[model samples]
Target: MLRADVRAARKRLTGRIRTTPVFHTSVNGPNGQVPVTLKLEYLQHGGTFKVRGSLNAMLAADPAADRVIIASGGNAGIAAALAAAALGISCTVVVPESAPHTKVAAMWSHGAEVLWHGTTYAEAHRYATDLAAERNALPLHAFDLPAVVAGVGVVGLELEEQVRGRPPILVAVGGGGLMAGIAAALGRRRQVIGVEPEGMPILRAALSADRPVEVGASGLVADGLWASRIGDIALDVARRYGVRSVLVSDDAIAAARDYLWREFRIVVELAGAAALAAVQSGVYAPPAGERPVIVLCGANAELGG
Candidate 1:
């Protein structure tokens, strides 16, 4: 998607979604403690950035369409359900069995007909696609459509205007939609670095292979970043924009999650903490004098007492 598309999405999504706030904070960087900007996307509707795309897609869908369907690991399904409910349309979400119960319950609370199938998101996605065809319903992809990516690009537009000066951005990648959208929005003006869990480095693997390929997804945060393969649209945008990819270990992710909770009182999920883990673990060291921004992508974790 182009910058123009992102701008149009911003206008279309006006009053429909919240412009998540950005907070300045100090984190343990590679060279001792350093300042960083945190985009609190976890506070977004549906508790994730997925709402932007899902809502935009629904708005652009045919008015005659009465039903929507999607398959997600968790956050995206919740987004679709919320959007469908707001639009007064019927929605059915099919999630993998591994999806967290809290997420499924959230979808149900949002008035979506939820179903569980398969062991992985890919399998669930296939089932959802077939079901959509059978039901003649519009299918909303989690991160692989032009409108969805363009909708997500609005985050980059907001960040560019919010942050002082042009700073490199670190974003956690799942199917690579968020990274691609941000990179497309910023173009070559700012660096967009994608962070992935070591156990589910689909974007990193796709970048190395110069194409999307299937990879195993298993780790502390697999539920959010468990896409078996990166989307073709995301890969193409990353290549065109020269987006950098880094992988962080599960230990580092857990540590980063704890740090955010203890130090910042930010209860973000593992996927949201992955970007911070890159800096905290020295996996992605920023250049001296260059300020970096980290996108806290989600906050759907169950924090128990």
Candidate 2:
């Protein structure tokens, strides 16, 4: 059912979004001589990859689904709101206290009612779940559903089309949605790696503990990467597909972001910079005779840089 659903999502998502391009980046990392392919997904409209899954969820679920509700730290909410607006449906997003004012404003700008829940994502999710049930709204999961995962997989499928062969390494992670989609899309391929910030190693910690444990959010990348726990759906997909997880630090991510601005002349958010941090900081050193790919997932940033 999940596989079929994902396929349907891919079909539904076609022509609805831009398939961002991939280019071999020349940035030198601590890991010796390895060419890197950058999956420039930030070029996609809505300024991030969230639109893929948001649109997919909206299209796949009951179109008659009145009042869609979602829980998000930010990006997903904006995506949900945009999707709902396009579909002519209403949406409400519950966000954590830590969610930036900019994000809440963005959600509101897209026509989503923003409610501040507790201090963390889990608490917000619970509140959103209750509100969704109470309002008789259909829930659009932030991450962790076959439809959502498949929509994200479109990024991977497009990457595969661009690369056409094993790239030796590819990296991405979020609330585990992007990684789950990439992993399922790449199935059994050992090179696609999932990278997370040290403080929000929901997926990595899950791999170590063999279960998803609540890890309070911390780090610059905390905005998008830190979910108290990995999505149960994401964890299952990851574990079943043998995806590897690694952690990088806030400092490394900052440097990576600076590097992108300085060298590549690109703008990306903290969560979007993790894979670059992993390589440059030696958090994820590539093996000899292997290539690497970094998923530049988003660019939801404060303007006037």
Candidate 3:
């Protein structure tokens, strides 16, 4: 998707979603305290940034369509359900058994018909695709579609106004939709770094292979970051924009989550902390004077003390 498409998506979702805030802070790094900006997108509606794309896609579709179907690990399904609720359409979300109960409950609370299928998101997606055809429901992909990718690109546009200079952006990737959108929107204006769980480095693997390839998903944040393969559309955008990928360990991800809560009193899911983990763990280091912006993408998982 192009920058113009992202602007059109922003127009379509003007009043539907929240323009989340950005906060500046100094984080303890291998060298010293590294200054950084955190885009607080976890505060977004449906408890994640997925709502931006979900709302935009639903709005662009025919209003007369009664049913919409999607498969998600968690965040995207909740976003789709909330969007469908707002549009007064029926939504059915098929999620893998490994999905967090908190997310499934949130979808149910949003009035969506929830189905538990398969052990992994990829398996659930296959089931959802078949069900969508059987039900004749308008299928909404969690990522990979042009409209969804364009809608997510709006985050980059918002950041342009929020950040003073074009700072390198670190974003967590699952299916690569959010990273692709941001890369497309920013378009070489800023460096886009994609972070993923070491165990589920779908985008990293895809980039290395020069195409989408299946990867095993086994990590603390598997539910959110577990995509067997990166989407084709996302891969194309990443290649076009020269986006780079990094891998973070589950240990680092857990530490980042704890650090966010202990230091900033901010709570985020495992996937949400992946980007920060890259910096905190020294996997993706920035220049001494450069202050990179990290996108805190979601907080949909259950909070435990």
| Candidate 1 ranges beyond 4 A from true positions | 221-225
Instruction: Encode model 1's per-residue lDDT on 144-250: one tens digit a residue.
Output: 98888888889999999999898999999988888988888889989999999889888888889999999876777555337889999899989998997899999
**Alpha-carbon lDDT, every model:** 0.89, 0.79, 0.89
Pairs clashing within candidate 1? none
TM-score of each: 0.96, 0.92, 0.96
As a whole number from 0 to 100, the lDDT of residue 171 in candidate 1 is 96
Residue-level lDDT tens digits of model 2 in 75-139: 88888888888888899999888887777788888888888888777788889899989999988
Report the lDDT of model 2 for residue 283.
72
Residue 282 in model 2: lDDT? 82
Pairs in steric clash, model 2? none
The 10-residue segment with the lowest total lDDT in model 1: 216-225
Cα distance off (Å), candidate 2, residue 139: 0.9
The alpha-carbon root-mean-square deviation between model 1 and the true structure, to one decimal in Å, is: 1.5
Off by over 4 Å in 2: 1-4, 31-33, 221-225
